[model samples]
Target: MTTAALGPNRTSRLAARRGRQRRWHRNRQPIGLLYVAPFAVLFAMFLVWPTIYGFYLSFTDRNLAGASAPSFVGLANYLEAFADQVVWRSMGNTVWFTVLTTIPLVILPLVVALLVNLNLRGQWFWRLAIFMPFLLASTVVSQIFTWLFNPDLGLINAALGSIGMTGPAWLQDPKTAMTAVVIATVWWTIGFNFLLFLAALQNIPAQIYEAASVDGASAWRQVFLITLPLIRRTVLLVVALQVLASIKVFDQIYQMTGGGPANSTRAILMYVYDTGFSNYRLGYASAISYIFFVIVVVLSLVQVRFFSRKADR
Candidate 1:
């Protein structure tokens, strides 16, 4: 007993030694960095360096063609972008598209997920049907929709004719071009949001609904009070993600409309591409892109503040 009091037992010493070893292992900073160095180098080489260089390019006249040497132009490109009516118009179109798509995309997914979560008939089939389009490549979806919206022989117009109604020249008219793009985007992207909402719904306990039912709560009431509150975070997440995605939309619109019909469907990103590659003014494109980037950063900050307040409440 005296010996035990004077020194820790051998087993206790061994455990204490193991604890120290674990702490030492965890604190091996250089070794941990060595393990991560390859990915770090690749990320820096591909993403970080390019982002930094592009920002630098925004201040200079960097021609894509080798016709002229790059010269520092300071804020000249930014000033030009600020005064350009087309840039403002494209920004407006982007916001309009975001507004048109965000509401339906968020609401439809939630509704579909709620119904599917009730164990409806053909559960797996419903899930697959809802999510299959998201698995298709953007280029394929855009091409299919392009053909579907064709003025002459498209199925949509034929279906309209069967109802004795005239279909507008969907893609050929400037008035309808943006609307067509919005429709295509919603159909292509809604599946991802559906899965997010479905996962959230599944996480909700079944007992809550049962208790509400026993207490005389109707289906609509349960949805309004219980389900919505439970899935509020998921809804916000979907909205934020959808807004960002819509803002950055390029691929489908590029392939389908080509920002045509008088550039009515031109997005800011499309403008950037046109400026950089088509016009061969890489510096001006970089400047316009940076302006759009600043706007995005502001929106993100606002969302963060809003979500933080919501969480606190």
Candidate 2:
């Protein structure tokens, strides 16, 4: 055929293919919507509506016990939050806890994962032993640690006493209270990060290590050059997750210390709870929570951007 005649036939075929795609998409649109409808409805009802309602409540004086309706207070709640020294103190405590826990949470689990990945005897037992703590409920973990850290009667103090050393009250004193909580949190949650790292490590191709071995690379060298570089993405994910989890720490502190020793361990979430439920200042609590929500969102965005740039490079 001549070039001009062939061009028209190709154009018609392309137009027909486009028409079929459009018709197929139209036919499947209802089914696709049906698949997503349940999740969409739940998200709107539970997440979206509550978020909007909470934001609205932040601008009002919604006393829990008051018989009257919530009164519009504009920025009064926010202004009060800024001036509240307790709020600032609680925020500082939360930041300190995050700093204290982030290092161990990110690093120790990696070590455990590496150890478990070794071709050792009874590897399954080691994996199960390390990960069992993570399967326990937060309350159960707290209770276990509570007994272990009891000032005079605790096993920790008893162990110290045998060596002529006195152990400081772990959960009672302000200096050691947060440290104790951090220890318990690390023990309880490191399993999760361990599992994440183990999965990532296992996904690494065995042939890469074999190639390194053929090149006379030692085990340690292979880990540094081949394994670590490949799992950089997983490491970043674990760090980000640990940071966010540390920031929102509440259950352990609440169950263990109750923000005691003059509110030294009062995390931001605990402060919010006290304000909303204990003090019956729902509006003020909402303002504080919204402020925290913004901080978390900003931190998450920063982490995402940092990882994206690292990945691109």
Best by TM-score: 1
Error of 1 at 27 (Å): 4.5
How much lDDT does candidate 1 score?
Answer: 0.91
TM for every model, in the order presented, reads 0.91, 0.91
lDDT at 85, model 2? 91
Prediction RMSDs, each to the true structure? 6.3, 5.9
Local distance difference test values of all predictions, in order: 0.91, 0.93
Candidate 2 per-residue lDDT over residues 244-286, each given as its tens digit: 8899999999999999888999999999999999989899999
Summarize candidate 1's per-residue lDDT along 17-125 as a digit string, tens digits.
9999999988865788888899999999998897888899999999988587899999999999999999998999899989999999999989999999888899899
Model 1 vs. true fold: TM: 0.91
- Evaluated at residue 253, the lDDT of candidate 1 is 81
Q: Which RMSD does model 2 reach against the true structure? A: 5.9
lDDT of 1 at 207: 97
